[model samples]
Target chain A: MVTFALHGVGVSGGIAIGRAQLVSHATLEVAHYVVPASRVDHEIARLELAIDEVQKELTELHGTMTRSGDLPGEFGAFLDVHWMILNDPTLSEAPKRIITEQRCNAEWALTQQMNVLIDQFEQIEDSYLRERKADVVQVVERVLKRLMGKPGSLPTSVAEERTILVAHDLSPADVIQFKQHHFAAFLTDVGGVTSHTAIVARSLAVPAVVATHNARQMIHDGEMLIVDGTNHVVIVNPDRSVLSEYRLKQSELDLERQKLKRLRGKPAETIDGHRVELHANIELPGDLAQVLESGANGVGLFRSEFLFLNRAGLPTEDEQFEAYRAVAAGLAGKPVTIRTFDLGADKQKAELDGLARVAPNPALGLRAVRFCLAEPKLFLTQLRAILRASHYGKVRLLIPMLASVAEIDATLAMIDQAKESLRERGEPFDEGIEVGGMIEVPAAVLAIGGFLAKLDFLSIGTNDLIQYTLAVDRSDEAVSHLYDPLHPAIIKLIALAIAGANRAKVPIAVCGEMAGEMTLTRVLLGLGLRNFSMHPAQVPTVKQRVLTSDVSAIRPVVERMKRTDSPAKLAALLDKLNA
Target chain B: MQIREIRLRNAKGLHARVAARVVKVAGRFRSRVVITVGERRANARSIMAVLMLAAAMGATVRLETEGPDEQAAIEAMVAVLAAAGDRA
Candidate 1:
């Protein structure tokens, strides 16, 4: 066997050594066979039966999704659209007509009709709508699998936990079904970092390499596969020495993971007895279980935008309230700071008309607090819901992208109005809930005195802060290398915010990718950062870093790091601080 | 037969979910609903046909209905098309 490698985008970070379990692409394997005149009706009946079975299957899956509430709203809406397409005469009826006219097998007829619809979808100019072709393909594949007597499920004979799933592409529905199996890793031939497959893979905390281009076609079933997700490489049929080398690396990772688990129950305190608070940033209430298991002090940033994304309509206040209340109450009296819907700029929904226009520069355009102020009705609805949820547990409201004191005053006024409306309606809420501002914009950091005086707390969003400070779009690959978190200016801005908040005696935390990053953990602690919020899976590892550090000793090293403008000196200073 | 013209008022025009909603509304009446956008015509009860029309926001579409409930069908189809910001 030849040992080779495949490289792609690594959306999640980990290592997995398992046998490749190929996911059969039913759409590509369709066979065309002509039916006799006498059997045309039989072929049509077969297609109908398959459609019926698929409809039932979709209905049951939807019910299970609703009952468990494990998946997001977008997944449920996708299922509903699939169900509608399955029942539409355009899908269920067109293929039967083709079967009669062409005297072909059920699968062949369905494939022909699917091709016609995909051609029409290809002509669509709107990218978002054109992407609906994938949904149609997924729906048709389900029915085809039924007609072929294939159940469209993972092979149960294998030990699924030790299996690496290799597929050409995976729809959101397929990813949801695979989530229950707890596969070791996922490798697909096509998907970007923001693809549904990648998002699910990250949440699963598994090693996944997407856009492999040909991993599904080249690798045979039951082949030895080593998925190095951190390096975005997959090794197939590795030689003996290479296998042993990877085995050692794999065990080292496992042992380190086990060691981190032991730190979960221990306090995230430094060697000098300075206590640090570690919180988890969650997007959905379903993540509460993992948050608790990781022993996070509380929920740091509950992004309210997930409720609004990928749906046709905005979520009603009651729906928002239910989600917020679930997370707040689930924390068992621990604080959960829910950020207002940070929609717009790569997170825009189709329902908002004002955001429909293509902004020349979305990063600098109307977003976050600006959009909220522009559309006060929508903003107030979310505010009222968050307030209502605060009655259940410790809930705080955090506003995003506040660059001006006037915007802050406008947002505070809107919150007051929401409270007034709720009081008029005779609803109960927390009278003195904390309101915080996210210091992502450089202007906000420069005007730190206003924020420290007005807001109850503060959170430094290092991702946006770095992007704005460096004038780099992190998503744009061409200039992404310029987006440096270790830049001296970023350090100065963050240090200034921390110092201002500490001087004012206001609580502050870093709730961004920087918080979980182990390399920068000591740097932040040395700069007097006592609170950190990151992904739940990252809590244990960062906690491990916090336990071994001496904050008092690293402060001077970090101070020297803060003054150096040279990249080389800064890098060396960071090394010394960590050393 | 009754024909009425209305422009799509939703931000996304006739996207998949919106097209599906149109098909569902058209199915509720005993009328045959056919919508025409530019030169392309589609059976409103068929999701694929409705989607193939590719009607964008502000695109003028003509709705035709002929059956026992033609009047009700025209009214319902017009309402669905004219719905702004589609809070479905």
Candidate 2:
């Protein structure tokens, strides 16, 4: 077979060499056939048997998951929903009626009823509820597979040879089942970075390339495949020389991963005995397990906006409280810094009423603390919830995008009001919960003293800090190349914030992409940053960088780096600093 | 036969998981439970039908249950519908 390459988005990073195992897309390939009048009853029986098998399959999967108790609670809930959908009369009874009326095969009859149910789901006004159509489709697909006599489970791999799954798409249920099989990697014809397949792939620490267009059709079963997730490339039926090269690279990656795993139990201390705290930034409470597994000191940033997104109306105080409490209690007394919902500016505004005016420049528009300050009720509800959760464990409140002293005073006042209300209600909370502000705006960095005096701690959000300083929208592809983090002004601002916080004895951390970049680890340490927060997957690699560096030795080079204005010269100095 | 109106108290209203809970609870009883939202009626025991109702938070839905155990079924359905958060 001729060797070829397929390119797509690599949501998970790793390398894998395996044989292709194509997951059948039964929904797309269901065969429709007319049944004779005498065979109508037999067709209806076939549909019933298929539905029964799918129900049994779901039940078995649920039992295995409950016994293992390793999957998230949501997985069990997903299985439950699929089970209910399978048994719903629309799925179970309507299809039989369609088979009797249309005199069609079992698969075709089921697909016809599924389309009708999906059409009804499409009429749902709520976006979140409407997305349930995918569940309906997935459930029908399961029954279709059974009706076609194709078992849904993966074929056991040949001894010692890895198997990679290639499919048009994967439902969350399918991914959950794949977890038990330990597939080497996943290649989907369509999905984005936030797709269920991508999220599960990252958690599994496997190589996955999504949105491969027609990967399901192009690659044949049992074809020799090489998945380079970091580079977002998949090689099929590779030549001998190429196969050997990829095999060598794959082993190197494996060895590096093993080395990182060993560092999980080690402290993030520099060679000169200076200790650095490495924390993880999580978007949801479910990520706490990974944070602990990565050996992070605590959660540095919990973007609470996730609870407020993708739903109609704002999250109620009780709803928000449960989420915050889960993270706080899960940490077992470790610090969990929960940032209040930082909505607006790239976040959907449909949920928040009266904030729908499209700003000329959304980044500079009313967002973050400004948006919260504008809507005091929303802000206070979140504040009350966070305060209530503080009773569980070490919880800190971090305010985002504070550009003025007035915003700081106002936010502090709102928080005080929240506490007073809780006290009146006899609700217990940590009275001395540390409050912090994100130093993202250049103005905030310049006026760092006001923040240092008012807030209990400070965190440098380098992504926004660089964006505001350079006046570039990073998401705009045309001007994204101009967004540089290594600019002299950006470095000076970060250094200033760190120095100010250190002078006042206030805790400081960098919780942005800059903190996770292993190449810039020494640079940050030299600037007196003792705390780093990043994605859990990045902690070990950055900790490895921290383990080898001497902060005192890099200070002079860092000072020189601060003085350098030329980009090329700065790049050279960065190389030398790492060396 | 029993009919009563109950407002949805959950923040997410009748989303998938909540609908599943309703369906599971309704399936336990022999009553034919029908939930009506602004003239859109759905059998509470069918998740697909209940989800298509799309009753948001604070939406006042009419629950009608009729069978030998209609009284107990309506009470249970009311408890699930009036639940706050995901407690149901």
Candidate 3:
């Protein structure tokens, strides 16, 4: 057996040894023949019919996705992207040109058109576009399958056994279809780190190495392969010693995973008796199960945006009430910190329609509470729903993107209006719900004293705080490399926010991407952050770190880190502390 | 022809989603629109062509529109590119 290795950018971290499952339909075999002059119109019509079917299929799939319950906002966005690709004149009109001018069969003509489109995508300097070449290929393949009279069913899911999926590229739809099967790892010839497939792989906790260029061509079906996603290496047909070494590594990882799972029941406290609250940031009502399973103390950030997304028109108060009630009831009296409608910015604008403007930079535009405040009718509807549900369980109101005390005062005033209106209607609701604000903006972080005076609690939204402070958009690959969480400025900001909250005796929490990261848990704890709100899947791992860490040991180190001038030194200091 | 120069203020620059938005708005006008970033020129109404320009967050691109709705088209395209306070 020929043994070899391939290197790729590791998008997710883990080690897996699985049988390679080649999912190659890479180049569809299409016959090129001159269409009869009279039948040119007929061929064009045939292609149009196939396009209609594909669109119909996509519409149905989008419907299914809206109902899927576990997916993130990106899934819907990618679906829309694919829909746009299908409808683009490049796809529809260009192929017809080949069919009419060259008198070629629809299938061959479509392939030629797709090649031109791919070439255009390939020429785009943005690597994001280069990665999107897979998306173009996926769309073409779907159409080609239809033109060829073949059922375009995605390879029947990843098999039950530990299977390393070797594919030219797996679309988000294909990944969703393979939902039931267990995947040890995924290696694709095409896919960027930001692609939906890569995002799903990370969320699923499966090891994945993408943009490998030719993993599908080199790896044979049913062959034993070792995927080390952490190292960005895939071992094909490893000899006896190598295979055993990987087997040992895999078992160790399995044991570590089990150990983390066991930490679910343990309290998240540092070794020196500093107790910290660990909560989950939930995206949907369905996530409550995972939250409870992970033993999170409460729901820290219940992103209410999900109800507003993928639906036509605004969600009625009753619909919002029902969703909030389910989560409140699900938690069984555990405090649910509901952040009101952090919509806009990366959210689909289809539902918003004319209500929202197309934000050029949504990250800084009318989003979160700003959108809520501007659209008071919409804001009041959500506030009324949240207030209505507060009576059922322990519900805390959290406002996102609070930059000034004036905004807070206005929000509080609105809350009073909602309550008075509720009182007049004789609606039963909780009158003393705890109010909080997300310190996402750098202004908010610095103005924590103002918030602490008016708010019951505070949560740092480091995701945006880092982005705004660093002037780096994490989603923008062009500047994504500069998006650093451990930068001295960020650490200093977090420390200052926490210190301010601590001095004022206001409870504080971190509910951002940084909270979910295991390595940063210790650093955050060191910075005097006593509460962490992250995804449920992250709770156990973070709790494990919390269990082992000594706050006193890290406090001094972090104090020095905050004073460190260089960004490199700041990172080194954090690494040293973690070590 | 009406020509207007604007900077990409969106954090992610004129990426796919931004380009899609640009194409959608540009397509609404009868005007033939062209966007020029640095040395590269792209058709404002075509998503692929607009994306090829690869305008980063701070890059300035000139929008040129020629038709009956030239003024309106340039204004709309500028609003999208300048994504001003209503960030992406």
* Distance from true location, Cα of A159 in model 1, Å: 1.6
lDDT of 1 by residue, B1-88 (tens): 9999987776667876678778889999999999999999999988777877878767889999999999999999888887634452
Candidate with best DockQ: 2
Docking class of 2: acceptable
Q: Candidate 3 - CAPRI tier? A: incorrect
Expressed as tens digits, the lDDT of each residue in A368-440 for candidate 3 is: 8888899898899889999999989999999999999999999999999999999999999988999999999
**What's the DockQ for every one of the candidates?**
0.36, 0.46, 0.09
**Regions of candidate 2 where Cα sits further than 4 Å from its true position:** A36-39, A60-78, A123-129, A153-161, A305-330, A347-360, A373-385, A424-427, B5-14, B55-60, B75-79, B84-88
Write candidate 1's Cα lDDT for A1-579 as tens digits: 999999999988899889998877888889999988999999989899889988887888888788877566678778878888888787898998998888999999999999998998999876667878888899999888888888664555458888999988887678667767788888999987756667677778789999999999999999999999899999999999999999999999999988888888898999999999999998777788889989999999998877765565567788788889989999999999999988778765544633565678878887888888987878998999999999999999999999988988999999999999999999999999999999999999999999988999999999999999999998899999999999999999999999889999999999989999999999999889999999998999899889899988988899998888888999999988777
Off by over 4 Å in 1: A120-131, A153-157, A347-354, B1-9, B13-15, B18-45, B49-88
What is the fraction of true interface contacts found in candidate 2? 0.62
TM-score, structure 1 vs. true: 0.89
Residues B16-87 of candidate 2 have per-residue lDDT tens digits of 767888999999999899999998999998888888899886688899999999999999988887664435
The interface RMSD values of the models, given in order, are 2.9, 4.5, 8.5
